[model samples]
Target: MTVKNGRRWSTANAYLRPAMKRPNLTVVTHALVHKVLLEGKTAAGIRYERKGNVQEVRAKREVILCAGSVGSPHLLQLSGIGSKAVLEEAGIDLQHELPGVGENLQDHLEFYFQFKCKQPITLNGKLNWFSKGLIGARWLLDRKGLGATNHFESCGFIRSKAGVEWPDLQYHFLPAAMRYDGRSAFDGHGFQVHIGHNKPKSRGWIRAKSASPSDNPEIQFNYLEHEADREGFRDCVRLTREIINQPAFDPFRGDEIQPGNGVVTDAEIDAFVRSAVESAYHPSCSCRMGSDDLAVVDPETRVRGIARLRVVDSSIFPTIPNGNLNSPTIMVAEKAADIIRGKGALSPSDAVVGMDENWLERQRSGSPERVAM
Candidate 1:
């Protein structure tokens, strides 16, 4: 959440800002990179298109690719550095044979488990034009008020069931029932908890449609393709219902707004999840890092079998984490930077983490007090 002074902080502000003044740094925008100019197995530079004009920039030493999950794999494929079959079908001569370049795509999918609120304390009350104007004015004037925050003040992470080593489900509680695009879902006051099966077993892939970079890649995240993921969603619905129906919410809770009380059976829950779930947009693990045959990059972030070329983004993640990709992606770049500088690895933390001793037997250390609905 790296937020301060009422503004969200991003990598550009944190890392790139200071480096902008350095003589060695050059920032280019509004340019479409066509491909990496390769010298046999080594990356020598890049070819790009700017304002309909083609251009090439030669690298003095090496080429570091940080084009992100989708862009990175797509760019690699365009540069003739992907699967032999894929490159041949796309009418590009193969420069390298990395079968895992665009494979192993992963992402998080979540749905808003919404409920009508009997009380008018939620952010639904602030959706009117006048209220929004006031909120905006306050923030612009003093950098304080409802407009200063993303409205996701509460969140939780818990395992879907017992026998799980760690939390596989994540929650983001929002005080309003609305779509991500700000469209209201309810006519009155309501709230929701964005719940998701974080560690999905389902995997998909991204492939280049053609040799042209202008053509978007064929992306598919065969979500819920696995039975375990479907079961996980069922658990998500039931567990979220149990948590939200506690005595704590009894005073303000009115009725379930999504996956309504009528959706009781497993089939019904599955159907609801299938239609309601949305991407969390945390796509990663395309050009995964490893020492295996399918690995695209090696332990040091260097592209496999290719020198002077490296990928420094979430594209190199061995596997997607249970949380957001922002921090993890930053960590990847930071670690790659240290590796490039020939720095030794940092000492691992020896801090102790608290966990329920009976975690293997039960989801919680103690049973939560429950009342029959």
Candidate 2:
């Protein structure tokens, strides 16, 4: 597959055309949520700012917070529903104190193992304006050509090393190399393995700077805070090198442009990871689901102390999923919709998820590095 298509099909403004035609669902623009209006301890409605005017929307049945991980916690804190100390510092009268509101922030962080391509088969040549326009025209005329897919065809779900119980590493192979933000890092044809540990022991948190709703909240993804996480990165680098160096890629593989030849030592790899690693833009679990003390929402997605309030987003994910947040968020939204409609949930799918019992041993079978460790 090639990434001839633009990113995030549902995010573009044009995707809202169908939603805009919905009579019951009113889409508001240029509005910032100021607060969740609460009568005593019950969530009544919401207040927002639009065109310098404060507007209120009353909820007839429930108030669902779908602001996502970062925005959900930020809005919760803005509505005086977070840690007691944080609300006190922000001078907002605490409505409901959920200490875990912004805790347990998790994300899928990745590092690119980029290799320069020996040939011009990659997307580097088609990135210019002329090629882009022709590709776009071809796509607009018929949903085909290089503009159809993300060009991310192959992927691997493997264990990082021996002794792991399951597949803890995820790899996404791209036929072109570039920065995560789409900037070309090298002016040549190349490929990249977007690889990272599926499960990270490191945790982070989000906090509101003040009670102001428009102010951006503080976000910290304390990545690679655990020794195991660092070790996982080391394994990711090594395993990617092993794959790219195989005979299959010998025709296209040129040189390792990312951690290069000098980054062999464990310390060197760790340093490189620390400097180059980036979030896969998949943040979740800031407001986790559970009945535990650290949980911000119950299994039903309701805020503990606030009546008629629910959180329906990835923010309530107990842990980040192994993949991107889009699909999981869709699942969450679907479930929440059923709940909102008062429909009985369908029977469990009972889809069996199996993994090798000796995943770790299997991972390290031919890899001598983990044996020495």
Candidate 3:
């Protein structure tokens, strides 16, 4: 069988959409999984809610949590696999004291530097009514056009400086005029380079702010706390400036719009970055897997103190990957499906895994390599 998977869309669009027609798989969208029903420490089923009523559904073999980082941790906490104090207060029996269940949270912190292009090479200048109509026509006829732009058309993959060897920094070049603010402030003739950390040392956390599933979980991304992270961030900013000044982007050159051209000092950059940077929306590692006491799950993605429940999402990453996390998250799910089906999974990184520091050093030197994880 041949399957064509698009690059950027979520699994719901690619896999579940067509698979829903199959009788073996049932698609439940509106249902909210409230908790994992346990039978003698084994996850036998799930308690879910629909409309105003609650119900339970059994999993004959396993309950894989495909919930994203935040959702998965909340599910674990609700299922009594999180902090002991939090679980007890929520009236959940303490099944585990896995402090790491909602810890080790890492996210790509993004800083956008806006600029005005000299010419109209930026996407902002091209988004007129006619352009929109043409692009829409192309998309309707074939699944291609401006609609297919996932941004970051041109990217810079490098270390912060020449001495470093691993790729610790990444730059996403956007051809359009975008804003850190919402779509309203969008000017039609601007360009931006979104600078981000490949391996942010400043870790934060995910916590169930409220018991209600509708309520968003509190995400504390304590970014730029570590000295190394701050230094790395400064290097990333300098690198971004250097890349923008290169001949490849000369035609798109505009006045420095953010922190402006005058903000050159490291101290100024640090202050500006802290105030301006926001989430890359790549939250992960809240339910880290390891052999340590704090680890919420084991190497196999199974809950440390429970059985038959596996977290197959980004949460199980012991250490968050060094790039945009969606691809890595899908790989985790793929490997997990094998484990759940009694098929042996591949441990690609275990045989020749290097430490984070080595990778960071490599990034600092200029060659930001994609290491297997």
Candidate 4:
């Protein structure tokens, strides 16, 4: 299988770039899937458009959707496998009635506070041409400078209190400020720490705003709706402030730049969080896994009541993972491949790294490999 990162890692770089010489895999680009073509009740192929022309790509054995959360649900709805009401409203014929096709959307909410560092230990201080050139030179020579940073510098998972069974909170440390540049938000600037409730009890939804596949769906997340969640986030922020105030960080301290030095009370912090928080862009649970008919996919990831079709992506995560979804998404694909090839599901840890018993034991003991500030 292709290996780079995950879906965000281009298939060209991960799979095609290395395997162009292989004769078995056919690679196509700029092809947009419009719908799944069914032969009676089983998927026979897919309808796609390219260069303004619609065509079909038939699979001899099966069809799988590797599209991310948004694209995956959109494809399902477009293929007449969504709620009957939505399909009729969009003037599309219904093939399947999976009412939960686009429900249960959840994502990590991130809020950040920027500070003007008194010293030059931050990325914001180096945006100038001179420092940037030096940094580029170092990366060019050694492949290990500022370029090696992956935005989130450190990570940790914690349960809110002692009795909780699973870690509910996640933290990410950053060495720069963050910005929202329209298409998506980004983090940059002075050292900052991001704290989020990893397993939010709250849920949201994604729905088709219109019939056209070109139309982007609406994303409505009711974040921070639970009282316990509010308290947890408040604690996370306060803990971050405490970390910044620690003596180990004194040399890089700077004036508070966001929610500033004046914000201390829970109410003020709540207001700041509501206005400033944005998506960590890790949406999931729209098509959850379960035994109930309301569930979108069965435990094997086969769409309920659908034949010869499967969804192999984040959409099937009954609950979102404790950290970045890239790892889990890859694991799902790997296991799915084995299942499809008649080899059956691989042993838990054999296919996925994080599912190891040792890892779970570490998490259970509250002895995570690392803890973010």
Which one wins on TM-score?
Answer: 1
> Per-residue lDDT of 304-349 in model 4, one digit per residue for the tens?
8889888988988887788778778777877777877768654555
Reference-based TM-score, model 2: 0.91
> Compared with the true structure, what per-residue lDDT tens digits does model 2 show for residues 263-323?
9999999999999998888999999999888889888889988999999999999988877
Quote the positional error of residue 71 for candidate 2 in Å.
0.8
The TM-score-based order of candidates, best leading, equals 1, 2, 3, 4
Error of 2 at 78 (Å): 1.1
Tens digits of per-residue lDDT, candidate 1, 1-373, equal 6777887888988889979999989998999999999999889999999899999999988899999999999999999999999888888889999999999999999999999999989888888889989999999999988988898888888888888888889999999999977965678999999999989889888899899999999999999999999999999999888889778999988899898999889999999999999999999999999999899999999999888999989988878899888999998888999999999999999999977777788776654554221
Per-residue lDDT value at 129 in model 1? 89
Ranking by lDDT: 1, 2, 3, 4
TM-score, per-candidate, Cα-based = 0.97, 0.91, 0.86, 0.83
lDDT tens per residue, model 3, 1-373: 1123323557776667888889999877788888888777889999998887898899988888878788899888777778877666556677667778788998888788777888856677556789878877876777576666566667766766544555678778777667655364356578887887778788888876555666666678788888888888788677677667777667777787776887789899898888888888888888888898888878788888788888888888877787888788778877777877779756556577444465533433223352221
* Candidate 1, pairs of clashing residues: none
Q: Is candidate 1 or candidate 4 better by TM-score?
A: 1
Which residue ranges in model 4 land beyond 4 Å of their true spot?
1-12, 116-118, 178-189, 344-373
* Model 3 residue 182 distance off true place after TM-score fit, in angstroms: 6.3
Candidate 4: lDDT of 175? 71
Candidate 3 residue 180 Cα shift, in angstroms, is: 6.1
Model 1: weakest 10-residue lDDT segment is 364-373
Better of 1 and 2 by lDDT: 1
Best candidate per lDDT, number?
1
